[model samples]
Target: MTDCGCDKAKAELEEYLHNELCSTDAEDIREHLAGCVDCESELHVGRVLTEAVQRACRETAPGDLRDQVLLKIRTIQATH
Candidate 1:
C-alpha cells in the first residue's frame, strides 16, 4: 500500500530474520535498508532485540515452555 516500499520492507523484516521470506522479497528489503537510514536503524534495533531475547531464552532454559506453546498452538489450530 505504501509507494515508498518501506511499509512492505518493514512488514517482511521479521520474516527476513526468520528466513521465512523468499529470496526476492528479502533482496528488496535489503535494497531499501541500504538506501533508507530510517529502515536501516529500525532493522538494527530488530536484530538487537531478537538476539537479546534469544540470549535470555538460552539463559533461562524454560523446560516446559516449548511444549506448552506447541500444545497451545495445536489446540488453537484444531479449534480453527
Candidate 2:
C-alpha cells in the first residue's frame, strides 16, 4: 500500500513490461516495481498476457487471410 496507492504507476508499469517506454523512463519504472508489490503483480500480469499473445500467434497463422492481404498489397503496389 503506497501513499498514493500506485494506480498511475501500475499503468506506466504495463507499458514498461511491454518495452514501450524509452530507456530512462523504463528504468525508472523498473526501479519502482522492484520496491512495490502491487506494481510488481501488475507487471507480472502484463508479462503473462504478452506471453499468451505470442503463444496464440504461433499456433494460428491464418493462411487464408494472410494470402488475401498479400494479394491486396501486390495489387496496390502494381497500381501505384
Candidate 3:
C-alpha cells in the first residue's frame, strides 16, 4: 500500500481516529502513520484530545445547574 502522505493523513486524522473513514482510506492512513513519526505523533495527539473530549462529554452537569438551564430554556420558549 502507498503512503497517503502527511497532508492527506493530517487532514483526515480526525476521521481516522473516529473510525469515520472507509477501509481503503483508513488503510492508507495506517500505512502512512506506520512509517512517519510526525504523522504518528499527530495521530497520538488527536487520540488524546478525542478521549479527553469524550470523557468531558460523558460528564453530567450538576443538578442545580441543569435545572437552572432547563428553566431558562422554558422561559425563552414561552416568550417565543
Q: Candidate 3's residue-wise lDDT over 5-77, tens digit each?
A: 9999999999999899999999999999999999999999999999999999999999999999999999999
Q: Any runs in candidate 2 off by more than 4 Å, and if so which?
A: 1-5, 61-80
Candidate with top lDDT is 3
Clashing pairs in 2: none
TM-score of each: 0.68, 0.61, 0.82
Q: What's the residue-level lDDT of 61 in candidate 3?
A: 98
RMSD of each: 8.0, 5.5, 1.7
Backbone clashes in model 1: 0
Supply the TM-score for candidate 3: 0.82
User: Candidate 2 on 1-80: residue-level lDDT in tens?
Assistant: 33323665676766776688887777777677778887888878888998998898889558999899999999999999
User: lDDT per prediction?
Assistant: 0.82, 0.76, 0.95
Ranking 1 against 2 by lDDT, winner: 1
Per TM-score, the best of the predicted structures is: 3
Colliding pairs, model 1 = none
Show where candidate 3 strays beyond 4 Å: 75-80
